[model samples]
Target: MPSVRTILALIASSVTVLGGALAEPTVALPATACTTGAPMTTAGYPIPYYAQATPSTGAFENGYQPEPRWAGQHLVGTYTFGVPSPVETGFAYAQFKCQYYCLNQSEGGSFFVRADSKVGSYCECYDDLMDPETFVNNNQTLIGAWNAICKEA
Candidate 1:
């Protein structure tokens, strides 16, 4: 017969295994669009916004804070920049179908904004750090769309 110590050990091990199985499952965030090295699905899709070779990590993807216009805009996203350690600084454009539009913290980082035209043929890019990003329809079209989409909010 097993001693008390042996019985206790068996019970403890069983609890540990059962606990893990009973624990709630975790959900995964959506993948980032326009990754630097990933191959494009087709000639024009996925688009290449920016790419850097570093240990950069992004937070969990979430819905846009202020929200955006358009029905297909990404509702989940994560920012990839922060203070203390700065990354690259430059401007690039891509027509990506992002799951969420990333936001740049005020401290510093590569902040980007996107606005798609109604025709779906053109997309406007903006730099969160500055107001010098490319503009289409003199910003009216994008602003109107955003307002219209976020109106219910």
Candidate 2:
């Protein structure tokens, strides 16, 4: 397990950048942790968990617009195009305060990409998708584009 300080350090160093500009605001992001009792992923990966609390800013939890979805809840960014996603920086912003924070946020669970023009590493599970920065200097996690990466485990 990663220490909270380690996770926060990853967040700070791996913040995404666009044209060399930090896309994710310096707002306070929370520490996320998950554990699985049974065998986890078929690949032996970490199971996901939710840290249900509003940060300093970003979308609300479980509320979508132009559509009703997700545990009868939705967030503010769901309807608005918050950032240019799927790219390193855009994914950072989304993960930082992604309208749909996790797999449960959006029904599609992927969308809000950084525009097809841009691209970045798309990790599916573990902290790789949700937190990204652990291994990247400027990685981002795009939403609403899991069709290519999603599959039955």
Candidate 3:
């Protein structure tokens, strides 16, 4: 004995609930994963959406390379080590370009890197809301390292 609109509303509510249950959760990273209070600059505009180190082997999206230099082409730095939301940045860059921009570009992804002494690092690149300035402000250690290492190079 319900109105048609009421019945439609109930159906929509059920669908929403089911959808919420099926949707994947966003990636969350520890504050410690990123360096705190380190200064970072976009001095090199078009910061290479590629890693300086070799890209590890995995089910990566297209256009990723393990080595920075290959066949007279050098992949630039997509991110500085220990940056907040590197994973998120990677994901956004991938979607924006339709290609993989960093290692482990998936949510809940992890990888081993030379930096952090080869410790396993998690991918935190899911959020598209972060801007470059805000990212720099949030990740001090990463910026400091980039300035010292990448900028100097």
Candidate 4:
């Protein structure tokens, strides 16, 4: 009893909804981990992790990259920095954690330009354009821990 146009419109709507149903579910993106604001947590644990380099948005929480080493030691496998040279230049040390590939981009190094902002402790944020951020890491111990975690991962 439906008209031609009405039937066609119904078929099209059905196809669109059915297509979405047949498609695989999308994965959730990682969160930010900048220091300008207080560290955040999921459930109860801290979302501490690193990225290969700052993301396009340049927020730690936006996404996470894994580390690959501790201090100057090797992690496990050969890795290529996901970011560009300009991003690397800003990092103090760089590496990835071969063990924990699924855990925070494998414990890779960060591109922080501070003297106090480590993993846990709050500081400021860093940027290649604006003035230096206050959450960037500055503590040697934390940096060491970061590298070590990357190696173990």
Strongest candidate by lDDT: 2
The stretch of ten residues in a row with the least summed lDDT in candidate 4 is 122-131
Q: Candidate 1: where are CA atoms >4 Å away?
A: 1-3, 9-13, 20-27, 33-153
Candidate 2 local Cα displacement, residue 81, angstroms? 4.5
Candidate 3 per-residue C-alpha lDDT over 1-153 given as tens digits, one digit per residue, 9 for 90 to 100: 999999999999999999988968888854322211222223322323322222233323332312222212322223324323454453333232311333234321112122222322222232121212222111112111111112221
Choose the strongest candidate by TM-score: 1
lDDT of 3: 0.29
In the range 26-100, model 4's lDDT, one tens digit per residue, is 998643322232222322324244332332354443223322122124222233223223333222222222213
lDDT of each: 0.28, 0.32, 0.29, 0.32
Point out where model 4 deviates above 4 Å: 5-17, 34-153
Assess candidate 1 and give its lDDT: 0.28
Model 2: lDDT to the true structure: 0.32
Name the Cα RMSD for model 1.
16.3
Error of 2 at 13 (Å): 76
lDDT (Cα, 0-100) at 20 in candidate 3:
88
Clash totals, every prediction: 2, 19, 10, 35
Model 3 off-target regions past 4 Å? 28-74, 77-153
Q: Supply candidate 4's per-residue lDDT for 1.
A: 97
TM-score of 1: 0.20
Residue 26 error, candidate 4, Å = 2.1
